[model samples]
Target: MADLRPQAMIFVTEYIRNGNNATQAAIAAGYSERTASSQGSRLLKSVEVQQFLNKTEQNLNKDLRVMFADHAVNAFNVLLEVMNDPEAQHKDKLVAARDLLDRAGYKPTDKVVADVNTEGTIQIVFSDKMKKADSS
Candidate 1:
């Protein structure tokens, strides 16, 4: 389970279960459409957000009777087929590859952690995006 607020849990689950559409998920989470894409991208980078997504995906797979090792293997096999098919759309192949990588425990990004003491003060640091921006 993610240590996120209730609204965030809703956003995370909706984002994953709804074709990975962040904008729609943000809207469903009550964010303004004008800022939804950026908000969704930010949420996607949160450790708690990714954790919730992975947890929910696992739960959903289990509920769908696809949690068995054999089933997972079969699913991967299908993804491979999609990825290798010459006639497959580029987008379909990319999606299949992404799904395969995700199911096989490949994370394309590192996590950023923030530690706050029991005091009432807060210390925040930007790591991922800021680092890239600075390098650029």
Candidate 2:
């Protein structure tokens, strides 16, 4: 990665931290209010800055996946307990079972209905230009 200037680094950090609001990030990085928007746009257009943002996003996604996986077993166990408990209310058990099935890729398909009503004449016109070209 290219060595970013202090202000550029701050802009990148603030851009991510502030929900990808470039203008706000530039302002937070001490850019002039009048130029913050353009400065942010320029920084984001830089190859080095883009690479940094992509890498940061990838790392954050990986970390979140790991965190979720770590607790997946506990979540499944709780759901199973609720689903299998005979004392549980029918509604509660059904909801738990549905959740488990949905997560397991056994969700029911949704039904869709479409209504169409048209009261207009349909017109089709052949262009003389096409015929003229074909004749040539």
Candidate 3:
């Protein structure tokens, strides 16, 4: 079987959340504008679908969510700092960030640079910001 597409998976999850009208959701899900009703019916009738839907519904937050909006600006600043290095490449950004993070008492993992767009601009997705493990 082929690997599941992320968009399709997300669409399914969204559909499970608000699926009173199956045909309407199918068109919105990009699966098929015409076969939404049948597809939604088939999925709704499946045991696997029932379990998946129940689990997802249990995890869903219907209310407005809390966010660290203060952290958002700081995050953008950090990105700017990473992008300002003379090299501005993955390896260089990682090294630069590692030094700064270490000095600030945060021990984040060494950055792994990935070029997602094939445009040569490296992206460093930091895995963690671990506090000093133990000094005492």
The candidate maximizing lDDT is: 2
* RMSD for each of the candidates: 22.0, 14.2, 17.2
User: How are the candidates ranked when ordered by TM-score, highest leading?
Assistant: 2, 1, 3
Candidate 2: stretches off by over 4 Å = 109-136
Best by TM-score: 2
Give the per-residue lDDT digits (tens) of candidate 1, residues 1-136. 5369887788987887689999999989988999999989999998988888888888888877744766878888899999999999988998899888887789556545455668966766668886797699
lDDT of 1: 0.83
Quick one: RMSD of model 2?
14.2
- Report the error of model 2 at residue 134, Å: 52
**Model 3 C-alpha lDDT per residue in residues 1-136, reported as the tens digit of each score:** 0243454445457676575565565566776867778876775676665565566665564322224456656765776687576758877686667666665689845544455666767665543432233332
Error of 3 at 65 (Å): 11
Q: Candidate 2, residues 11-60: lDDT per residue as tens digits?
A: 88899999999999999999999999999999999998888888888998
127: Cα error in model 1, Å:
61
TM-score of 3: 0.35
Question: Candidate 1 or 3, higher lDDT?
Answer: 1
TM agreement with the true structure for every prediction: 0.46, 0.73, 0.35
Model 2 clash pairs? none
Residue 18, candidate 3: alpha-carbon lDDT? 70
